[model samples]
Target: MTSSPVPDTPVEVIVDLLTKAQDIASYCDNMISDLFLAGQTLKMLIHMSQAKRVLEIGMFTGYGALSMAEALPEDGCLVACELEPYLKEFAQPIFDKSPHGKKINVKTGNAMETLKELATAGEQFDMVFIDADKNNYINYYKFIMDNNMLRLRGVICIDNSLFKARVYLNETTDSNGLALREFNQFVSNDPRVEQVIPLRDGLTLIRRVPPCKITDDEVFRGVTGRFILDRMRLDGKVAYVTGAGQGIGRAFAHALGEAGAKVAVVDLDGAKAETVVEELFLKGINAISITADISKSDDVQRMIDAIVSKWGVIHIGCNNAGINMNSASEDTSLEEWDKTFNVNLRGTFMCCQAAGRVMLKQGYGKIINTASMASLIVPHPQKQLSYNTSKAGVVKLTQTLGTEWADRGVRVNCISPGIVDTPLIHSESLRPLVQRWLSDIPAGRLAQVTDLQAAVVYLASDASDYMTGHNLVIEGGQSLW
Candidate 1:
């Protein structure tokens, strides 16, 4: 499929061995094309995906297996299946000679039986490469799907799908070519996956959609599709954001809405929340407003209940409500400290707890808490002991919750942002403090609300499923100082 010439550089140990295997194939009059380009492509994909476990349906002289194994991390592994015992015998010694050879598990016999055994053992793979018998391609796909051999969001790459370009001959009687055409059509018609044919011989890449049981209509009829970027789009997802009347919270609400989420904008000021909802509706985004005092458990529950009643589920929760107070530590009153803690720390906990209850039942959710640069470093020319401590508590809360809920499929992460050019920091009274922050910040400018948009989307989407207990810092190098 790939006509590009192989690089003229000296071959690696595995490549050299594969070259020798090619000579063997010629002597035996066996039909085998050097899969050097495909092997290289697989290596790049393995590295990009950080894939640890791979399943290969065919292994000829261990070229493809070795390529993927070499790209994998030290603890990574590849299960290579070859139907013929002779091929396995021929490839085993070559695999044993390479540094990554030990990573390859040469399994001889029928690949279908091997897949069934792996499935029965509850084994899952980050990627599955199918390049064995042509007649069984459709059966292999069905087996993989029915048995859940691939993990949710895992990839399946099928090689030689074009069958030497004979699949296009309408009147041809080639059995292998006809079988490939049927397999390609079957995969193309599958609604549960989004696929692409990247190479000439039809290197088809298929990605299983989210395991949350999203319907084909929901995936295909909406803005979401098989495109990698589209996977980040949160179509049909319901999102809730606190303090959405203005500033960073407002920006988060808008960003999530733009990404196809139905948003609930919660604010203490009922009028302000409704105003923001109206603005969202003007942009054709599905949104609602809920007035709640986030510090109060009753208010928080009511808000969550209202959102669930309207949308049936909560997929994203942004606990962004908090009050800031600036006073010298010695002069900071107990009332100020308690109030800050109640709103910033206690409010965040209440939101996470309420959301966690629903998400734990659903087995999936993303929680984004708004922390601050104060959580990591003391700000210059500003005395806000209570505020700094409250934000620090937020970071700890996020990490603790993230660890506890990770296995439950709910992720809790916090964003620590530097001084932003928002109303909170750009006031006349805070002009001197803002200038001091700029001097310490290497970026020489305060972050805009838009700067944090992509980070919020990343943590809120399925893209960050494996990431939890992490505090994403968007401080423009201020904390580095």
Candidate 2:
């Protein structure tokens, strides 16, 4: 598997910037908005550190407004314009509570009219963000320019430029798309502003100048999305990985252990258990082996008991052990169906039940369940009715339990992967036929174990704390239909 991203100064610097922003937001007593905007602001601050004065043309509940203001230098100032009169009362409480309230001016009234007045008032800003009135995007940009409020080298960000792919269609059109299309073309030929990078929705980054040149830095700057996956790691957490013996299980055990998690390497095979422990030891992560079939109630209870006895608490529990059987529904005897469910579904139930009890007590936990893409949509060429049905059960089980326990702090989520290139699929007897079956996949290939690793880590980490009761389908978009 590939190594995790290297720790870098950029990441830390962004973190520090967010720390200050969060402090400001918290100080203002708008912790909710601060908490919500923290991630987004940290990402934006990473792009342009030299940014000072900022103008946010729309301040709804003061989230984006306060976030940008918190990132600016102490000498920097931010101006926010809100069209609604009562928003000041709604957002004022948070700003008044914030220590950096002095740095921001929230102007109440129609955004366009207020922006027009800012131009008349001879106000200039180094950075401007326009996220108001979708149909009036072009109008907002023109007004900002005609007033000469944008300084040379200043950047203007226009949000929601994509309109959820609606703008790209030639038919079933919208006035919003029409206006956005005109704005995109107008900016393309305009003597001022360079670079437009579409994020979710879209983010157009424009640098003001005569015959504006799109610098490599600006191009890179517009790719402002936080590598969200990079945020998952045990930097200072603990994890328990089941079936942590051979194959993909061992890989996951080693990965989490190497990433600083104190791993509980578990398996039904005693020798394999010890082998994983040795591997984790070599990697310098604290580890212990427990030989137990995860599906057994007695075994799961002992595992949990051992874990709590040693570590005092569990942070992440990965329910990942599963077996496969290939048989037509007619040929698949009741015995075989029971055997499949015994390990896949029943085992998952036992483990989650045991882990859920502990996690519920702790009041904060992440349980990452492995549910194959078979749970989302069935593969066309094969029929493993029992396996597919069991996996689907796991998906709903996660969702149901997640909802039941959400208010208590334990978040349960599942990952559904498409045909993964595991040892199970690569067996000498099966590889040839499996390769032929892979042709039906639009990605033209099977997924790698490493492909599932990130999703597992995210579901088990703080990055996905607010997410639960969801099946994160990672099947190369195979189930798109």
Candidate 3:
């Protein structure tokens, strides 16, 4: 059986310890076989399953046990069993030296007896690794099934089922080989679990199937329709909203908070962010505030880091921090143009990139960028050339990332809002300009901050699971005029 190499530092250390133990076991002729699993393989299995409680039938020298334990979370536990008392004694010292040693509980006794005791205690495990006596493989399988020791949909991994390639030999008299051959067939015929993977050394992975409750009639009715409102609910989800201090971004923070998300209000103005977060708390929503300049990469990274350090994962990101500048196309200074792009385009890119990393690793995320209706059509009376161009670039940036990350489980979309009744549009210098643009809007009124809230919630929820790479236009027929 070929072994996969482990390159990680922790796995490498375990491999070293296993090699030393293998030499000792061979020199002593203790009949303690060095049929230990590859460190990388065991770690991968534990991590992929997110196994909190693991049961290892054969502890051996603790290499596999240590590897699995190290992959678990701080509160996770591993119960290990070994037939030889000396093997536990030999491995305990090594485990003691590792920080993850506390997670491993080594039990020395007859594995069958230990299994029976665990079953009687009603203990369940997320995963069970069997690498003990080959002859009793089938018996261990039956015990786990009969006692309900494994949780539903849990994993059962059997190692060394090939018996050194002797299982394929029909005339082999080896008792272990014959037993393994019989065990493989027994598991194959069992309908409760589906034999999933066959890896090195005849390693077999069996996943217990949960009972199917949905019927053909349910399928015809479209099961998703029943939970339409529930699907939109973001209970227990964590959301980060940039520029949440005031204006449209503040409205988004409130909307997400009301929809059951724990909101992180991020703004360059630390006081403003905290004020908004305090208001959210008074409204019975969980919230926090973070100060960061999105244009600076270090600040943006720190913002994401702080949120993840506190919440463990980021489910939604709203890249809304931006600046606006109104200047004639010919009279716009370089500094004015650069500052607009820095916050509007560069800042948005940095936030998306940072949040994208977290989302890609989690395999599920939603990112909504704030584009402007000026992206579709330049404002008639406004002379903000830089603002219009920067927003247009945002639309294309969203489309590019949306297409690239859709398959990776993260959806990127942008919202282009029309003239909104915010401080940004009601400034003393823009009052005349604002009134002139209102005549062009068929709705006859500037958009309210609340008008954009529903659209943001819809894009953030699972109700938009099938949508991506599309700019959701919230303008009230102004672009048409």
| Superposition-based RMSD of candidate 1 using all C-alpha atoms, in angstroms | 14.8
TM-scores of the candidates in the order shown:
0.55, 0.53, 0.55
User: How close to the true structure is residue 278 of candidate 2, measured as C-alpha lDDT?
Assistant: 88
lDDT (Cα, tens digit) per residue for candidate 3, span 1-481:
2244643544355565555565656563232233334655888999999899999999987888988998999999999999999998888877787888889999999899999989888999999999999999999999998788888768999998887889999999999999999999999988778886467767889898754455545343334633455577888999999999999999999999998999999999999999999999999999999999999999999999999999999999999988988889999999999999999999999999999999999999999999999899988777899999999999999999999999999999999999989998778788888778878999998999899998888889988988987899888889988
lDDT of each: 0.88, 0.77, 0.88
What overall lDDT, based on C-alpha atoms, would model 2 receive against the true structure?
Answer: 0.77
Q: Which of the two, 1 or 2, has more lDDT?
A: 1
Per-residue alpha-carbon lDDT of candidate 1 for residues 273-373, written as tens digits (9 for 90 to 100): 99999999999899999999999999999999999999899999999998998889999999999999999999999999999999999999999999999
| lDDT at position 235, candidate 2 | 70
Worst 10 residues of 1 by lDDT: 1-10
TM-score winner between candidates 2 and 3: 3
Q: Candidate 1 at 251: error in angstroms?
A: 0.1
Question: How many clashes in each structure?
Answer: 0, 4, 0
lDDT of 2 by residue, 347-383 (tens): 9989888889988988988888888889877765556
